[model samples]
Target: MLYLTINETNALLRTAHTDAFHLEVSDDHSAVADETEPMRRVLAGLPPFEPDAYPDSWREWDELVGEVTAHGVTMRRVRVVSEPLTDYVRFLQGLTDRNVRLGEDIRWLPRHLVDQADYTTDEWWLIDNARVAFTIFGTDGDFVGAALTEDPAIVDRCTGIRDALWRKATPHADYAPGG
Candidate 1:
């Protein structure tokens, strides 16, 4: 039940020292949006829903992912979103190509369809199937902190959900935001 600042959470995740990193995101938009300057500029420059307008400035992120993958660290992310996606979700979908290129296995699951699956209501990361981190936010939807735990029961539950959602989710390349 340790409440951690966003920076602290990031540091913990970055230092995971694991062979696999898995993440489940339930938010329409993350509070700490991608801060890389090139990504920032491209997102700012695009029109509302430009499908083919991927900016070519994600080198930093891509390279970091390349290094991680090269070291045999498998990374995956699954997002649960509602129909009629929010602008932020749409924006995130637009960025999936970059994610895919960076060696992340990404998936999207429509929210209404998760009726009977093991689920987590909050956003979390299940690292190496051993640790679970729930990211917490403030009232105004600003980035606040995260709670990290190594309880086996908790980890097992989250891992179950991750596996179930992964089975149900749409691959990034085939998923459409409003479909």
Candidate 2:
């Protein structure tokens, strides 16, 4: 039940030896300062930046994903979104190809496809199937911190949820927003 700063969580994530899974449940994370300008550009109909010219934070994340995957650590993410597609989700969709190129498998699931009671509402990352880091966000969608836990029961439940959703979600290549 220990809470960790974002940096701490990143360090923990970098330690994953086998696999890492991310579950995103929020439609808007506008309060993330780094994404503000990029999201604005997306909303204005500007095309995404070329991969070599990505913003610093994005470049760093891309490098990390590349490095991890090159070492055989599998990285996957599932985003459960409500449609007609929030501008933020659309922005993420625009970035999906680059993410896949960097070696992460990304999927999109329409929220209505699953029973809400089947999973916790919090966003989380399961690292190496051994620990769960739950992201904590403010009411306005600002990420505050993360809570890391190794309690087997919680880990098992999250693992089950991730497996179920991953099977039902559409791969990014096949997902058509608002279709």
Candidate 3:
């Protein structure tokens, strides 16, 4: 496994284009907790992040999606979640609308309905069906790091899984978010 820090991972993604940015989100990693919620900002009557650099995910993500989609790359994401949703998953659902508006096609699949769809214990990103960055998460579903690989067979397998799951997963609009 090739280890890469989160920044290294983002740096690589920034250079990506001409490929589909497909993510298989298998767990709720509480990543959204790190970002300041819009409602909180409204409650505090505060302004948006200034400069909106790396740590400012709201702006960084907006820029990233704008850049990637402008290059004709399709970004699709699928989440496999269990019933009796965790607080993190609920938070994620609240955040999906922003991602959808940013041009990502998001979907959700409940655990009972997973059936035979392929899934990794952790999350992964399939870029262009050519390369993959398998993100490692801790036992508590915290962000760990990622491994980058380009083996054709590995890419092919992940591509097959992504295609299959995406076809069956519920689109963001149709899926109900559990509490």
What is candidate 2's lDDT per residue for 36-114, written digit by digit as tens? 7778777777766544657877777877888788889999999999989988888888778879999999999999887
The list of candidate 3 runs beyond 4 A from truth reads 24-27, 31-55, 138-144, 177-179
| TM-score versus the correct structure, for each prediction | 0.75, 0.90, 0.77
Residue-wise lDDT of candidate 1 within 1-179, one digit each (tens)?
Answer: 77778667655656555534455454444444333333344457654334564343344456666776766777788888877876566667777786888788888988888855567777887777888878787776655778989899998888888888888889998986665
Which one wins on lDDT?
2
- Cα lDDT of all candidates, in order? 0.70, 0.86, 0.70
The predicted structure with the larger lDDT, 1 or 2, is 2
| Residue 119 lDDT in candidate 3 | 62
* Cα lDDT, model 2, residue 104: 97
Write the candidate numbers in order of decreasing lDDT. Answer: 2, 3, 1
lDDT of 3 by residue, 64-106 (tens): 8877777788778888887776655666676678789998889
* Candidate 2 Cα RMSD after full superposition onto the native fold (Å): 2.1
Please report how far candidate 2 places residue 49 from its true position, in Å: 4.9
Cα error, candidate 2, residue 124 (Å) = 0.3
